[model samples]
Structure formats: C-alpha cells, structure tokens
Target: MSTQARPGWMEKPRPVTQVGKAIALVVVVALVCVPFLTILSTSLASQGEVVENGGWVLWPTEPTLDAYRDILNGGIVTHALGVSIGVTAVGTTLSLLCTVFLAYALARPNVYGSKPVLLLVLFTFLFPPGMIPSFLVVKELGLLDSYASLVLPVLVNVFNLVVLRGFFQGIPEELYEAARLDGAGDLRILWTIVLPLSKAALAVVGLFYAVAYWNSWFYASLYMESDHWPLQQVLRTYVVAGEGLTDTTTGEGTVSAPQTVQMAVLVIATVPILIVYPFLQKYFTKGVLTGAIKS
Candidate 1:
C-alpha cells in the first residue's frame, strides 16, 4: 500500500480547478457588482453627463448629488422613505415576537394541541390562501387604507416559525429541566435561557422579517392609497411605471434627467439592505445551518 505525502485536507487543488473556481467567482462577483456600480454611477452623474451618455453611464465624469437632493427634499420619495422605515421597524418587531412565542410553544413537548396547531400552520404552506381571498379578508377586517394592512396579513411567516421551533428543540432538554427546578415558568425560561442562547437564530429570523417588510410593495399598493405608499411602491411608480417627476423641475423650468432620478431611487431603496446585511451576515450560516440541521 502507498500513501500520498500530502495530508488529505492540505492537498493542493489542481491548477486548472483552482483557475476555474477563480474565474467562476469573478464572474459571479461581476454579475452582482456591475449593475450596482452602474446604477450608483448613473445616479450620481450630472444631468448633462447622463444625457451625453445616451441613457446609462458606466462612470460619471463629474458626479453630483443633485438627483438625491431633489428627491429627498420634501418630495414623494421623502414621504415614502418615512413610510418604509416605519412599516419595517414595526412589522419586524411584531412578527418576531409572535413567531418566537408560537415557536417556543410548539417546541415544547406535550404542549396542548401543539401537533394540531403545527399542522394548521403547515397546511397554510401547502395551501396558501388565494390573493383575492386574502384581500377580501383584509377588506372585511377594515384594514384597507391603514398601516395594519401592510403588517397584519403576513405577520408570522411559517418558515421562520419552523426555523425557530427547530432551533428551540435543539436546545438541551436538561436546560429546561434545570430551569424548571429553579421554578422558572415557560416565559422566564424563554427570556432568560432560551432567547439568550438562541441569539444567532433570532438575529437571522429578525433580518428575514425586516427585509421582507422593507422590500414589500404590492400589499401597500393594493391596500393603501397612493399618498400612503411606501418607498418601494413609490419606486415602482417612478421606475416601473415610467412616471416623470415633472413637479420637481428647477427654477429654470428644466427637470433633471429621469434616468438619474430613477437610479437614485433604486440606490436609496437598496442601501438600507446593504447596510443591514453586514451585521446579520455572520449569524446566517451559524443560525440557519443549525436550525436546518436540527430540523
């Protein structure tokens, strides 16, 4: 019998394989980055530069923040921004709290009706209510034209609930027994023991809820009036619908190029997610993997 000199773990990859991986990674990064860079550059470009480029600018010759200023200065974009932030913050908190409670209850052994309750939740995944039915329900509940319309309909994500329940179940049984011996109730155990240890899972789930709320537009458009629309809905109106910012014209009676303004709106809509992702990224693998494996 013969053995290679290199340890299996330390064995060098074939040069071709390494090169292929490098190329693939570069391609993936470029695919993600190029559009983002183009959008940012176009957004920062002066109106004259954008016009000279004939639509999109790979790089601005002389960048200006005028587009951003024009949009953010007491316009529809500003109002929509406030709406998005408010909805995301409030919706994430409510969803997380409800999900945590439900998951904890379902994770506990011998909890009354836990199996049936879980089945009902899983049934929703298999047979989600139709959009029309959901809309009618919301309308019947008088949530239309209200902020609750945005949050209530999708409050507890079943996948998030399952992830949290699995994570909770992965906690050692002895911990619960020990807490019981110390006279800790379920709420106390959850607060002092379970939640503290499950920070990674909670962070991942919280981020999921936050991002969903932030990116949501259709529900807002469906339920709320245009004046109450969120940033995403406003972005959809301007970018997707090709509506112009005629009201934002300068004193010289010239409006900035629609391309620059559209890109600026896109950048604004995307930036919060980018800023938030770094903080939650470290928890993603640890939390999601642990929950997935345990489940």
Candidate 2:
C-alpha cells in the first residue's frame, strides 16, 4: 500500500519573518564577544603599552606572559586562585546533594507536610532572614573564620529545588509503576532510573551552583579572614582597592607591572566559568523547559 503525501505547510521549518530577531542576535553576540576580547587583549599587552594608553588595552602591539609569571611566583593572586577552586568544588557537591533530596521529597504526592516545607522555602526568598540574624547563627555555630562559612549557609538553593522538583514530577507515572513491579524501592528507582534520566537537569543545576560558589565574594568577605579570602575578594582588594602585595610575595622592590597583573587576575577568575559554560549549555534548555512546564 502507498501512503498519501502530507501538506506543504507541515513540511517546512518556521520562517524567520522579522529583521528584529537577526539584529538582536548580532547585538547580543557582539556585546558578549567585546568584553572577552578586551580582557584577553589587556591580559596579553605589555606593561609599557598598558600604562601609556590608560588602564584599558584594546589590542596588544607586543604580547608577553610576564604578567602570568609574576602572579604565579607565589603572589597574592596565586594563593587566592587555589582558595577559589577548593571552595567551588566543595560547595557545588554539597549544594547538589541537598537540593536533590529536598526536591525529590517534595515532588512525591502527599509527602508529609511538603506544602508547608515548600512555602517555608519560598517565603525565605521574599523575606530573607536578616543578615544580622544569619551572621549570629553562623557565629553561634562557630563557623567564623572558617571555610564552612562559605558553603554551609548557602548549601541549598530554593530556586534550584523548585526546578528539580518540577522536573521530577514531570516523569511519567508508568515509569515508576514499571520500576515498582520490578521490585525497586523509591531509593532504588531514584538511583537506577530517575537520576539517569534526569542527568541533563542535574548537570544544568550543578553548573549553576558551581558558578555561584566560584564567583562568590560577599560571603567570603564577611566570614573569612582577609588572609584566607578567595580570588574575587583578593582581586577586589588588589585590583579594585589598589592595595598591592605582589612585590611583598615576589621579594622584589616593586611590582613588574600593576595593570598587567590586575588584568591577569581578572582573566584567571573568569576563565573557569568560561570553560564550564559551554559543556552545560546543551542541558540548560532541556532541563529548564521541563521544569518550567511542570512548575
């Protein structure tokens, strides 16, 4: 038997009717590229050129890696880079686990007091516990001057929990029924089935948590001793606050190049996020749409 052909309208992709979308895409891409190009150029440019043409460098006439070397020679920037990496790794793992458990519980129908728990979580978003109260709690827990202060208080994100819970709820009931018939318990189902299926969601949410922790400085500034501060905080002190300790660590009388070193620090702080983002981008739309549709 021969099948009949479908209508022409059903065979074509949606047309890009408006010029506005094309222009917007161009503008958005250009805006993103310009800052990165500026940072890269500034980082590569020689100290003489940087100073002679103000603090900003559009393009390097002669590139050098002296800035990277000076910073790596046991300076403030190098120490702070290690601190940032450590905190980000620890924080992301803890945050992902906590969010997953809370979200999974809430996703189940008739979970005991799940509504109230969700409300409490959402309420915090609108009316956060005052900073003073939070600080006191951290102090009472004896987390002061400790790295725990960076990770623990912000361990679970309400938004991430909601996203995961919605995605969990969207899983077809037939899958759960099939797993149950095969003698799988809730934990077993989650581990063997749900989690594997939800990899995209997890990857996207995990990346968000990782990026937040990596970029965080406010909490570190408040809770950490200045000596143990993360890269962003140290960057603020040296690059923004103009308090240099490069020579102090280098055993030299003066810094090799202040502007180049500052740009190098900025580049270092930004590079990790840039590296992580492309890997996670594919998951974002898939995960976000599923969560959004359900929630």
Candidate 3:
C-alpha cells in the first residue's frame, strides 16, 4: 500500500476562502460601526437639526455639547444617571461576592450536600419561579420599594455559578494535593491559587453581572417610585415614550427639553457599556471556552 502526500494547495489556504472570509469580516465590522456612528452623530447634532431631519440624525450640520451639558447639569436625567451608577456599582460588587462564594463551595467535590445544593440551583434555571411569583416574593420580603429589590433576587446567577464551578473543577487535582502537602486549607488554596488563575472567567462573569444590573429597568420601575427611576427607565419615558423632560434644575426653568437632549440621554446611558465592552471582550472566548470544555 502506497501512502500519497496531499497536494500543497489542498493543504494550504485557498484564495477563494481567504477572500470570502475577508469580505465577511468587512461586512460585520461595517455593520457594527454604522450604528455606533449613527448614534454618536445623532447625539452630537443640534436640536433644530435633529427635529428637522425626523427623529434620526445621520450627520450633524453643526455639533453642540449643549445636549450633554443640559442632562449632566443636575436635571431628572442626571439624577437617573446617578441612580443607575449607584445600583450598578453596589449590585455588581454584591453579586460577584455571592457568586464567587457559592460557586467555590459547589466546586468542591467533598463539600457536604454540594450535589443537592447544585441540584437546587439548577432546578431554578429549569423552572424559574416566574416573574409574578418572584415579584410577590420581593413584595413579601418588603423589598418592593428598596434598592435591595435589584440585587437580592438576582444575587447569584445559576449559569455564572456553573461556569465558575466548571472552571474551578478544571484546576488540576494535583494542585490541591500539593497545596495540602504545604499545609494549605481550602480557603488558602482557593485565595492563593485558584482565584488568581481564574481571572479570565471571573472577569467574564463579573462583566455579565455588571451589564445585566446596569441595563435593568423593569425591576427598578416595578419596585421603585418615579423619582427613584434609573437612567434606562428615564430613557424609556423620554426617548421611547416621547415624553420630554422639563429642565427644572436650571434657574431658567420650565423650558421644553429638546428631543436632541433625550437622544443624548440614551447615548449617555449606553456609553458606559460601550467603554467597558472592549476590555471585557478579550476575556470572553478564553473564559467561556475554559468553563465549557471543563463542563
């Protein structure tokens, strides 16, 4: 039997495949850039120009920072932005702490009732106790009119916990054994070894929680009063519902706020995610793939 070597061209990249991939990549990049450019242009355009050109502003005749200034000057929009930032920071920290502890415990093979606890966690994912039921629970717990409503119900996301667990499991058994040989307890091993090594997964999961908390408005609207509303709910009212805000904060009060300002509010709310996205994206593949492969 003769073993023949394959043709060089067959083994190498084809021009057609390379060109096709290049085209696809260009299309994807263009698609992503177009929306961001459009939004940014719309946000920068003058109120008169935006209104004259329908609700969308493709390009600015004259750009102005007045829209940003108006919102940032302690109006309802600014207050809502503050609320969003507060909730996002507090909620992300609390969520990461709870998820880390829970995931670490569940990752341990010898932990008592770990299997049952994990089963209970997984059960919630399958049969999520529905929105109304969860709402009632929140109400019953007297969290209906408080910030805890945002963080408590969603303290530890099951999927994130599972991902962390899988990542923790993939740490070599010998590492644990070696740590034990050096008189390290589980806490010491985890703090000194496991966590530092799992930075990618931690970043990915932390960003997921942060983004979720930042984007959340339904819960805030349901649990909070109008004055307590976050930026998204405010955006929903002003931008989506076409309700313009009054600039009461300024000494020149009762001015009809421009739609351009509303558009700028939407842009401001979205900008934090845009800024954080690039940093978080680098971890996604390695973080997700490691957990997935281990599981």
Candidate 4:
C-alpha cells in the first residue's frame, strides 16, 4: 500500500457541503441556546411580565435578580440548597472511597475470592435490584427519612467500579513488582503508586458520582418528608403541580407565576454541574477510553 493519504479525506469539501455543515451547526446551536435564553429571561423578568408574555421570555425588558433573592433568602428553597450541597459532597466522597477500595482489591492478581466477588458485582450490574426491593431494603435497614437513604443504596455505582478496576488493571506489572521489592505493602503501593497514576479515572468517576448525587430526587421523594426534600424534589413540585411561590421582592408579598420561580430553581439546580464539568472535561476522554479499551 502507498503511504499516501486518501484523496477524498484530504480534499476540501465543495461549497454545498460547507453550506450544509454551517447550517446544521447553526440550527443545533439555536435549538440549545434559545430555550436557555427564554428560561433565563423569564426568571429575570417581573412576575407580571412573565405572566403577560405567556410564561416565557426571549428577553426581559427590565431584568432583576428578585427571583434569585427570593430563593436564597433562607426559606424552603434555601434549605433545600443546603440539603443538596451536603448530600452531593458527602455522598460523592463516601462513594469514591468505597469504590476505590473495592476496585483496587479486585484489580490485583490472585486475590482470594476475587473472581466470585467480581462475578457477583457484574451480576448485580446485569440483573440489578428493582425499585420495590430496593425500597424494602432501605426501609428494613432503618434508612428511611434520613440522609443515608439518599447515599447508601446507590453508592459504589457498578459502572464506576468496573471502570476503576479496568483502569487499575492497565498499570504495568513491573511497577507493582518494584513496589513489592521496596517492601511497600498493598496499601502503600496503592497510595503512592496506583492512585497518583489513576488521577484521570478518579476525576471522571468522582464527577460521575457528584452529578448522580446532585441530580437524584427520586430516592428523596420515596424516603424523605416534603420538608426534607432536596432542591430537585422541591423544584419538581413547582414544575409538576404548578404551584406559585411568593415574590419576596415586594413588601406586599405577591405570589409570582410559577414560570419565573420554577426557572430560577432550575437554573440554580443546574449551575453547579455547569461550573464543575469544565474542570473535569479534559480528563473525561482519556479516563473513559482507558477503561473501555481495557474492558
């Protein structure tokens, strides 16, 4: 075979192809940006403006942060924010610890019962517990109505564990042999060797855990009281039941249309993910690809 590139691959596209590609890109951008703009504008606009403009605004005539202030002024919405932050932080940390320990153990060679344990883990991944059984288990464990209900049942995500295990297995055996020669035990080897090299995978898995915990509301609904509901569950009520929140901006305490308050809540719930994702984006591809290739 000639060591030349294919002519078609190197050739510039015709004008028609270029135009079509540009059009497609523009359409995709508009589809995403338009809805985001409408929600943001609606949230910033006054309740009267939102109501008068049919629940969505492309641009607010006069933007105000009243809706945001209302939510952050130490009410249920504020409390829910606290609950969500706490749960995401604590849950992600615990999940990462448990997953790292388990994945490291499974990745090692000739460990007692490793195969059966790995098989059992994969079996759960394939056959997975149903909602009813999971609920019953949570209830029986006296986990209902507590924060543990949110974290414990879903901790150590099977996919994340498998990904970490695969990533760990890809480490060269020579490194392990060297660590053993230095009289470093498994814990020391893992701490000083495996973990430092697996930063990308750890970052990816931690991001996964954070996002999952932050976005979870179903479990909160099932196991928590209304007052204990996280931001998503509380926002769900606003979006689903069409309930209105009081406009704290006005001294008269007027009730705002659900759209502004609802959109504000949605934006708040969404912002943390937006902020955190960029930091981890650079690691995402390598981490996922390494695990996938190993598998």
State every prediction's TM-score relative to the real structure. Answer: 0.92, 0.87, 0.89, 0.92
lDDT by residue for model 1 (67-132), tens: 999888887789899999999999999999999999999999868999999899989989999999
lDDT per residue as tens, model 3, 1-295: 1126656555556778778888999999999988877777888998778878886687898998988987888878889888899989999999888888888888888788888998898898888888898889999999877888888888888888888988888889899899999999999998999999899999999999999999998998889888888999988876777764655644464454576776788789889999999988999998888777765
- TM-score rank, highest first? 1, 4, 3, 2
Instruction: Give the RMSD in angstroms, all C-alphas superposed, for model 2.
Output: 5.2
Model 4 spans > 4 angstroms off: 1-9, 244-257
Candidate closest to the true structure, highest lDDT: 1
lDDT of 4 by residue, 19-120 (tens): 888899999999988887788888899988988988788889999888888778887789899999999999999999999999999999768888899999
- Residues 198-253 of candidate 2 have per-residue lDDT tens digits of 99999988998998998899998899988789999988877777775645545754
Question: Of models 1 and 4, which has the larger lDDT?
Answer: 1
RMSD of each: 3.6, 5.2, 4.7, 3.7
Clashes of each: 0, 0, 0, 0
Residue 93 lDDT in candidate 2: 92
CA lDDT, every prediction? 0.90, 0.84, 0.84, 0.88
Which stretches of candidate 2 lie above 4 Å from their native place? 1-25, 110-113, 246-257
